[model samples]
Target: MKSLLDLLKTKGPRDAREGAESNLFTTAFASKLAQGQSAVPWEARAVEVAATRLPKSRGTRLLQSVWAQDPYMSHLSSDRVDRMQRFFAFATISPNRDLIRQDEYGSFMIVLLSGTIGVDRRQPWGEHLRLAETRPGDILGEMSLLDSGIRFSTCTTLTDCEVAVLSAEAMDEMMEHDAPLAASLVALLARKLSLRLRVVSSRLSDNPHG
Candidate 1:
């Protein structure tokens, strides 16, 4: 599968942006996976067992809130909703701890349930470029699922953070059996990309001289 970056490089900026916008809600990639095409190779890393689990009631409430706010989960059937609620594992990260490292292969993405995270890029000289600050309800590490399974930037918790971790394997399994679930995942990723594009546009507009 071609990475979005690779596809963008083949077109002019305007055309690339247009192409991305047009492809946002398409599930062609997921469809290909369903047909038994080669899956993107994600590097396996030791999984960290969650040290804590939310009480069932509290966890269900949290999942309900996420479903209400997230556009991607808006139209899901009750069965899919129940499945998602059970699929995630809660995780907590200490302040200044890295949640994701640039260039590392990742098999899971995180949905911030609370607190903030700083997204950064390492410069060639080893300095960090702070890209954005992500807050509650934001999704992180999704690029790993869509592209090469490699993370493009580092993410660190700015404050102690609580996140819901969803693995790619679980998602693949859901996609293979549930078409609605697959479409919802694609929509969620599309929404994340759209938000990022808007941010980039805003930055460019504010710094027209650059």
Candidate 2:
């Protein structure tokens, strides 16, 4: 399926910004989830194994302390930290576990409060391409989190890692309970996706093979 970004480029998919699951997650990926991980809901699947839930107060403090040093993270004001805390659940994952897998359905996004995550994609010709290594404050599964599209790459915990998760259910609650914060969050995600599309376009323009 074409990404919401792709649709946007052609002046379509107006609902993408509002977290629409219309054609994206409700398609094949959702079926796959029902067939395989049917016993557990989407959010439970994201927690993985060995991920201990951290207390809210400690988690908020930690999340506020290390927004992952990513300058893009600064798009969110630090003053909003306290309010944002309740919407997120903090967990620590043991190493060698896939936080998220390529081409799989995901209903949430994670902020890396601490620890390393290796982001990779499995190419059609059997190559495992290492896309990036996540740092503190890095966000994973955000694209899927926003659009409910299947993940484009796999994100694996390379070491013990602490993360803050924002699930779809939580987002819904936030929208109902705190509309302003929810709008701001959606705007932030839209901006981030736009920037990524621009970067990809520039790279494709530069690629000699293309």
Candidate 3:
């Protein structure tokens, strides 16, 4: 993926005189930042800190898998990825007994870099519904972040872990800059949903009430 700084210098332009196609993508992408212009002080601060500390590309397999299967990855030219990479937020979570639910953090994607996490999809009747055990190379919280929808499950750490977080605003800014990336992201969203559907289908087939 491209770093955020690279996107600014290479993808961003100084004026509208740049060719219409180039300008179009750049302009659209820039609009995201402008649209959030009225952000509160804390929000702006969060953006700044996240942007500045966003991880630099390390050519890891997990990243490579995401780029390969994620529809949005293809839309982003290497130049764009280099630029977008800059906005990534890095986080580390140690193994704990507590559970993390969607209501706590708004929306974000957690990429497991190490260890594992247990996902429990809550039932309508207020009961724990075991989902999947996520490990390194797995992506958690993507469903909510991708669609700007509510989180579907609760995640709990099983071991010390590190993860990459991509928030909604950051995602919006990245998409605004590149049309292809937006299209790709939508595709990725579809793929993920389809996979989940298949899993659900298999479960239903095996056990009618499940």
lDDT scores in order: 0.60, 0.68, 0.52
Question: How many steric clashes between backbone atoms does each model show?
Answer: 0, 3, 15
- Choose the strongest candidate by TM-score: 2
Q: What's the CA RMSD for each of the models?
A: 10.1, 6.6, 8.5
| Winner of 2 and 3 under TM-score | 2
State the local distance difference test value for candidate 1: 0.60
lDDT of 2 by residue, 1-210 (tens): 235444333333233344343333334345557577432233565454658877887788777777534455555577776788888988888888887888767777888887899988776767676667878877777777666666888889999998898876676566555556665666666776777668645754564443
Candidate 3 has a TM-score of 0.59
In model 1, the worst 10-residue window by lDDT is: 41-50
Model 3 C-alpha lDDT per residue in residues 95-115, reported as the tens digit of each score: 653334633333456566666
TM-score of every prediction relative to native = 0.65, 0.74, 0.59
| Preferred candidate (lDDT higher): 1 or 3 | 1
**Which portions of model 2 miss their true places by more than 4 Å?**
1-43, 68-70, 197-210
Model 2, CA-based lDDT:
0.68
Q: Write the per-residue lDDT of candidate 1 for residues 166-204, one digit (tens) a residue.
A: 666655444444445555666657676778868856764
Q: Which residue pairs show collisions in model 1?
A: none
In model 3, which regions exceed 4 Å deviation? 1-62, 65-83, 97-105, 204-210
